[model samples]
Target: MVLDAIYRGELLPCENNMEGNGRHKQAGKEIEQLLKDLRNNLSEEDMALVDQMLEQTLIICDTECSDAFQYGFSAGLLLMQEVQEILRKRVDTAAHGVF
Candidate 1:
């Protein structure tokens, strides 16, 4: 999946149209490992945040934009902010304990 994301230029060091084979396979393997580590270490709240972010991203990506591209970007930014808020709330709750 990470290899596909890299090949599609979704991941950083975005080499456009780079075929994922041979040496590039190593990079893909590394990315997969990193992702696994992230998943393993993530708290439940963090995982929830990731899930929300992905859901919003998918919704935005699927919708057709009649307005300028900036509108879509703005909407995505707002969704990201909401995800941040969720993370913040989780942190605050963890610190204070549930009332």
Candidate 2:
């Protein structure tokens, strides 16, 4: 997937988000670091799960969103879902480890 290539540092994100609004000046570097950090912190199995979730979420966006506005909303929802799921699992893990 192009997204996976971008995630894996095989591609850059829009040449530093040069043509986009509300994008960081160093968005590409930021994403690269973000992926690196994630790899460092998450186990290989968990990382694969996260990657699968991301792909599934974007697949939903491809089918469900008809316009840029809707696509943005879909993507945002996917992000929220990803964050919430990760946090929920973290909480569950910590809770279990404490007992």
Writing each residue's lDDT as its tens digit, candidate 2 over 4-97 gives 9868997643344355555554776787788789999999999999789879986886566446656786899999999999999999999899
**Total clashes in model 2, counting residue pairs 3 or more apart in sequence or in different chains:** 0
The best candidate by TM-score is 2
Where's the lowest-lDDT run of ten residues in candidate 1? Answer: 12-21
TM-score of each: 0.32, 0.37
True lDDT of residue 4, candidate 2 = 90
Off by over 4 Å in 1: 1-66
* lDDT, candidate 1, at 13: 31
* Residue pairs in candidate 2 whose N, alpha carbon or C atoms collide under 3 angstroms: none
lDDT at 54, model 1: 66
lDDT of 2 at 26: 76
Span of ten consecutive residues with least summed lDDT in model 2: 12-21
By lDDT, who's the top model here? 2
